[model samples]
Target: MEQHSPSIRAQAVALMRQGVPNRVVAERLNIPRGTIGWWRSEDRKACGETYEQPTDCPRCTTRDFDESAYAYLLGLYLGDGHIISKRKQHHLSISCNAPQIGLVAAAEDAMRKVMPLPSVSQRHRSGCTEVKSYTRHWTCLFPQHAPGKKHERRIALEPWQQEIVDTHPWEFIRGLIHSDGCRITNWTTRMVAGERKRYEYPRYFFTNKSDDIRKLFTDTLDKVGVGWTTLARGSDPFNISVARKASVALMDTHVGPKH
Candidate 1:
């Protein structure tokens, strides 16, 4: 650490206390930014001040943000995202298939668009990628995050979140499909006029164990004029199927396939 005169150190601290940025103070005083930062830290400690990382969270700051990206992110969070709001570990994590690089990028972009201040990173494990944004304010954005599995608890959106989803229903649906839904093609062979013919059926499927989540998805589909039905796997009905030709076409136009 480079030593500086007491008068210079005092001047730097005064400038910092007046809300001047560290870099600005460093430039004005011809001091290293690191030294400026160290002085500021020491001053705060001497004053018994607890430092909190500044955040630009829309909810906390009451500022306008990218609601379209937020709507999409909300769908993804409900589908396959989780938040850890522990005392020391605070972050939001969205799991995506490793093969779907596009989805991974989309998830990261959405996080950054919603809250650009917090850092975002990706972790690869097994066959999936976990996209994480480090911030405790995620709970403010997604109040639905709870201690238990989503399926074991009641999941409902806040009024503000509902408004965003209603405004950008297509984006929300796209996010859901990207996270926990898929489009598949089923084909069959038939005899037509003594000739063999093949036909294919394309549909969308969204599978979630939570009844509330499934209802939310179906309700949104209804609002968008897309038809859907519930499919029962043996006894548990966890899948929402969009098989009608018109509905399939609508989904294809908006949600399409993952990646």
Candidate 2:
């Protein structure tokens, strides 16, 4: 048979039928890639038959799929630079969490021996593309948090981390605040000057998923690099009130520019 792309195309299609990429077939057939893509289109034109799948992907339209292409795609999605295009695969899927994506991008980057934090581009998926991302649970960088033990592991979120979280609220995103010199249990529970008791604690409130109220916590502790620790039991109410009052006072003062 002629070794033109048409012939190569037939062989390539046969190989692809068993599932193989163009680059691999190109390597196997010892054919220049121009021929790989060229003859197929030509043959399809002549025969009035086309195997090309119409992808709705607007951003990725110019590119076809294969090993190198898939690698480029995965790299692109994971934020690789060799391909000068949109690096973020920021799929609307809630599957992959922030940490997992970061870790995977980091690892794949290392394996490919490419630079970390690749450059991206302006293209977008104009049509619907159905790619799935792996989901991950939120990982506390503090790594000390066990189930229901968030209080014991108070890892101060750095300003950069807070900023990243702010940019991508899709992360295990939250705003954080810290308290200092707190006696969670021992506090004066006296309204007058006589009978009083200091006791256990109630609850610990950390920032979760609120944006407007986010800065209310993060900004309050921006420059304050210090930390505090106190153990509070469930029996303490008044002390908790005092603590909250302290927090409120500080927040009102710091949160002010209007007040």
Candidate 3:
């Protein structure tokens, strides 16, 4: 009944349980090999279980999940996704119009990368493709979800989420734009001196009923030096237009047109 520091003991136990060699674990933790061996022996005796190196260790085999990918997926889910929780099961679903299959595929890829799951499947509903997965971590990842619709309630990002978005603003913007925004060629005719000239230019427009979400989008854009203008009030879907030449160019470089 010798007392050991819980933190180091816990680390050692986890590593040993994962089939790490006692010598390797001791070396990695800077602890004596004899101590790790003793702990392992005690665990086997107390639990009446065998501890051996696993032929296929999940921790050693699985690829590392990218935080940036999760951040982007979070933005997409915030914009166009929904979560359905029934008891212990949670399903994360993001729907994109059939025409925007690329976005749907990207969402599926993001889901796979973020979660340690086999794959995400897609179902065609009406004109939209729903990319979805059942993961317990969905709620933990997206605490912004509430009982009502996103716009009906307040939507705010935690400081950690903000930090992720700040570091990868382009990915966040791409997810936001891909879900609820679009890029189009806007044409306008103007009189130059005595002549009338018509020109078509590319612009990015993001529309959402949620003011908080719109603010988040514009704020992120500002951080990336992308200028945007909000249309007059009383619009059906609150609109933010990025029509400035430089802003459009920047958005095009990052988001492009969703195929």
In TM-score terms, which candidate is top? 1
Candidates' C-alpha lDDT: 0.93, 0.33, 0.84
What ranking emerges by TM-score with the best candidate at the front?
A: 1, 3, 2
Tell me how far candidate 1 lies from the true structure as C-alpha RMSD in angstroms.
3.1
Give per-residue CA lDDT, model 2, range 15-85, as digits (tens): 75566755687799887766666655665677787574433231233432222222222212221111111
Clashes per prediction? Answer: 0, 4, 0
Alpha carbon lDDT at 135, candidate 3: 57
Q: For residues 190-257, write the lDDT of model 1, one tens digit per residue.
A: 99999999999999999999999988898899999998888999999999999999999999988888
TM-score to true structure, per model: 0.87, 0.25, 0.73
lDDT pick, better of 1 and 3: 1
What TM-score, to 2 decimals, does candidate 3 have? 0.73
By lDDT: ranked, best first:
1, 3, 2
Candidate 2 residue spans exceeding 4 A from truth: 1-10, 13-19, 47-171, 174-259
